[model samples]
Target: MQKSLKDLKVYSSSDFPSYLPKLNALYDDLFSGGKGFRSKLIQMVSRHLSLKNEAVYLLAQTIEFIHNASLLHDDLVDRSSLRRNKTTAWLKYTPEYAVLAGDYLLARVMVNLSEFGNIRLIQYTAEMISDLLEGEWIQDSLVGEWNVTLEQLNQVHNLKTASLFKWCLRAPFVAQETYDEDIHQLLDEMGGLLGLLFQRSDDLLDFNVRNYEGKAILGDLKSGYMNSFAAFLLQDCEEALRLKFKKAQSLDEVKLLVTPDLFERRLQEFDQVNQESIDLYLHLMEQLAQALPEKEQGLRDDLIKLPHPLYWRKR
Candidate 1:
């Protein structure tokens, strides 16, 4: 059965161990703060198959575990003070606690996956963990560098951000006893493309936009990091413009270069790259649609809901 936001919200309302207040708090931090985008993915896919009742809880929990684990480490690495509008784990609690909490969540994933008793599910979850960590490492290596190529950045994001998403689309099929090679590969490709689109669209938010940038704008540039979309945009900037962007040392310099005027100019060049990325993401989702011969009604609504949010994101 497909779970609703109301459903998952109610299901997850109870607190964890009272003795482990910090751990419980960590869980709450990630759980309540985020919109459960990935959980939505799993829910959508589940609609198309005869997914077990247990699959909903296990799969939802697994996605949260993977996401929260990454967030704990992400905050420490980014030294970010705010996440979803509050102090981060490493800030409110000690980094040691954060690390342990993150580790515990990952361990919990194994226990959660075991409930499904599917080796493939567990194995895919394991591979996602590896991919997520590797993606983080690659991005970390690029920190403080002002010029990362679009292809390299996208490759890293695909591995890190999309790998888990791929799992979201495919796991339900695997769990439904409806596993197929083509569907699995197609879902992975779809997840990667969606990940690319989501991340790149998010990158545009860093430039300039009205109302729905969602997060802080131009935060990436001020921080001296380049995203996949920005990399494409930067690739075409004049030598002098490139030097200005590369030489940026503070938020002021970033504002001067990454203004509305400059961004609009760059959008022209970003058109081809943007189209390519859109095609990539759409193609993946298309494959998923094709792979499932008879999707359930709830699955259909969920699948329809998938693109709506992604489409409205600032670009």
Candidate 2:
């Protein structure tokens, strides 16, 4: 039977060693606020396969652990004051504690996977983690670089963000020992599209466009990071205006500098480009449906509903 998300407990105090109270406390705070989107994605994909429930839970838990670990480290690196409306881990706890907690989660991921005894799954997950670090390194280098291109940001997003999505798509099949190369390749492409659309939509939130979530406006600008939307908005701008754009502290300032007309035009163009990716994803879903066995065809229906919400931010 397919399980509802409520049935899955991806994290609990019992999962960690009780000897270190601080570590547990740090994690309790860290994991409590996340949307758990990636883990849910794993469950969605796994339901189509014939895998055991234990295997599905393992994959879900693994992704959450890796993702939350990245967040722990990311909060420290970004020096952000808040996450999910609560104080960031680095500030709430010591920086050293935050770092140790992040490292511990990653270590636990490997330990859990090793015990699962799937050599291929273990190796692939390790590679994904490596890609995530490489992405972070490249992203850190791009900070304050106002001239960074969308292509460059795409490279980082693919490694850091898309890698997780790709793993979510492929890992369930891998767990079931379905090693069909074609199926994996299509899933890879679809996952990449999903990640790009998601990241771009998130970047839009920085500009407060369709920002239903009320995320802090201009956080990326203030942080010296040029998000994908910023890169797109600045691509055609002159040097002086680009400099002005970087200095924007408020949304009104950003709008004034970019001029409301140009900003709207660029936003439309950005949405159109992302819409092309959405169309491509749907096409890939058609191909995926054909590659999947008849019994798993229902998975395509579930996945097709993702791109619209992911890119459009419609809840």
Candidate 3:
């Protein structure tokens, strides 16, 4: 049976002891009110595999802690003041404290995994975190380079986002000692595609299309990062427009480079591409469903729901 989000939260909350009141309070604030979407994803996959719920809870908490740790560090790196409509940890607490807090969570993850004592799982998770850091470094280096290709953007997201998704899907099997090469490969592909869809949808949110919350509009533009949508659409634009875009340092300057007609045309193209990607996501979901064992056919609907727009929506 699938665990409810509330149940997931209970597991997450009980994972740590309140030895330090300040740190505990900081974590409480940070973890409170989150949708626990990643944990939910793991639970869904666990349901499909009929894996042990207790083990799933631990893995879910591990992933969520790592994820929140990344966010705490990310908010500091980006100098973001707000996260999910609340003041970021770095700002509410101290930057130094925030850094340590993030590190503490990661250390806790290692300790938890060490207790679990699955060498393969630990090795894979360590590799995933390494890949995620590399993605962050690559994306940071690419900032202010407006000519970023769709391929380059995709590669970064594959490491940063898809890696976690892939782990969520395959780690349960790893826990079960199932090591099925075919299923692992299939999950990898599914995660890559789903990551692209999620990242692109997020990129779209930065470009004036209302979607997920958190980030401000044109945040990427101001930060000198050419988003996936912009990178793709810019490919079809003339060299002159591209040059003008390259010279832009702010969202206002970017707006000046694009006429209303051009903007509308690009948005239309983006919408078309987004719909195609959605179709592909659905197709992949269907493929996964067919490939799953007959006993797990009931999971098809739940699996499909994982990537549904409703799940992705913030408001």
Q: Global lDDT of each model?
A: 0.72, 0.92, 0.77
Best by TM-score: 2
Ranking by TM-score: 2, 3, 1
TM-score of 1: 0.86
Name the Cα RMSD for model 3.
3.2
RMSD of each: 3.2, 1.7, 3.2
> Can you write out model 2's per-residue Cα lDDT over 19-101, one digit (the tens) per residue?
99988988888888789999899989988899888899999999999999998899889998899999998898899999999
| TM-score of candidate 3 against the unseen true structure | 0.87
* lDDT of candidate 3 at residue 205, scale 0 to 100: 76
Give per-candidate clash totals: 2, 0, 0
Clashing pairs in 1: 47-299, 206-218
What is the Cα-based lDDT of residue 107 in candidate 3? 88
Q: Please say which candidate is ahead in lDDT: 1 or 3.
A: 3
Predicted candidate 3 versus true structure: per-residue lDDT over 19-121, tens digit per residue = 7766887898899877777777888877767666667877898788888888898889888888888999999999998999899988888888888888888
Candidate 2, RMSD to the unseen true structure = 1.7
Query: Which one is best on lDDT?
Result: 2
Please give, for residues 226-246, the per-residue lDDT of candidate 1 as tens digits: 876568767756667766886
Error of 2 at 147 (Å): 0.5
